[model samples]
Target: MIPASDQDLEQVQAQFQALVMPHLDRLLGFASRRTRSVAEAEDAVQEACVRAWLGFAGLRDPAKVRPWLYCILRAVLADNCERDGRRQRLVSITRLEDEHEALVGGDDDAVLVEVEGRLTGEVIRAALADIPEDFATAVEMHDIDGFKYQEIADILGIPIGTVMSRISRGRRLLAGAVASNQRAWLRDDGKGERQAEARRAARAGGFDGGVTS
Candidate 1:
């Protein structure tokens, strides 16, 4: 790769500061959606940012910068997931797209309500903490951070098959945990009936949502 000129480096840094830094929350939200843990999501994004900074010189096409950053974030998440021996459960990025569409369609009020009713940061952190550390790491790296299997394998110094297995297993475990938590919530609350109904709805929507752990 050609070395980035000083001007190029400065421009990259400026772009990161302007466009990327402002999107930290959105990026974290995206990571959390995939990894289901606030801590892991934060870690994944942090690592991704670090990698992006280090590899800024490789990013020749300014237009591709956003996608490139996302790619790095995903790679970091994948690596963490693999190291954690977490089973990978695939989440559809469709919800995010849907939410964006809702916003664009001028349903701001509905979007705000949905956001308000969403899981809290504390809930995500606690759930992540409940998972095995290694599994959490792997899930954050592979799924949330968006690392490729081979890249994760290289990063974690594990076999590629091991990376795949960890992702698969971690996802399964996470889904089971989410199901169990929902059941527990139903049992503990007076609104057990309503909660149960919600769970049913989640299932109907194919929200077999799993995390890295």
Candidate 2:
């Protein structure tokens, strides 16, 4: 808390407004993508703001304020999950942290272009929702939000290596999801076409009155 002196209180408020207020919209966008509903996102961001204000005085570096705010927001979400008994899925044994660097991510650009070609914004969002939250957050922050590895690490409080792995794996998972969608769409489209063709044939007297095969 700011000192009891009115002058100190005013100074803290001014400092917070200057350093933090500009990012509110961006923060809300981030929270919205991470949450299930807009209402949840709004409540989370609002709570994050309140917590940020309360802890504003302890912040030493103004330059890192954006990631600091994100870290706080993540913590708020985690706490909510814990309170609600949401189980956090952790890394499987097959994906040890050491192997993250070894993932075949050299064609990252090529893969991204392909994925973009196959998916629309709505489809991309759906794909993101289909993956694990941990991987999705890392990928979204890096590809969509344009945060660097170190910045993501700082915000997530995880190692840079782990962040890299999650993104690599996340991209692969997202591509798979997109492909699955395409297949499903093709199947549905084909079924509709077949149904329409059958109707056309019946109308043309191809089925006859008995409709024998």
- Taking all chains together, each candidate's TM-score versus the true structure is 0.41, 0.67
Instruction: Assess candidate 1 and give its lDDT.
Output: 0.56
Model 1 per-residue lDDT at 195: 45
Taking the tens digit of each residue's C-alpha lDDT, what string does model 2 give over 108-205? 65544554564655456555554456787898889877789999998888999999999997887666545434444235345433443333233222
Worst 10 residues of 2 by lDDT: 204-213
lDDT of each: 0.56, 0.66
Evaluate residue 97 in candidate 1 and report its C-alpha lDDT on the 0 to 100 scale. Answer: 33
**Top candidate by lDDT:** 2
Worst 10 residues of 1 by lDDT: 122-131
- Candidate 1 ranges with C-alpha deviation above 4 Å: 1-12, 90-213
Which residue pairs show backbone clashes in model 2? none
lDDT tens string, model 1, 25-130?
7578657655644686798899888888888778787655555666687688678767766553333333333433444455456544543343244333333333
> Model 2: runs farther than 4 Å from truth?
1-4, 88-115, 118-122, 183-213
For candidate 1, the per-residue lDDT at 11 reads 77
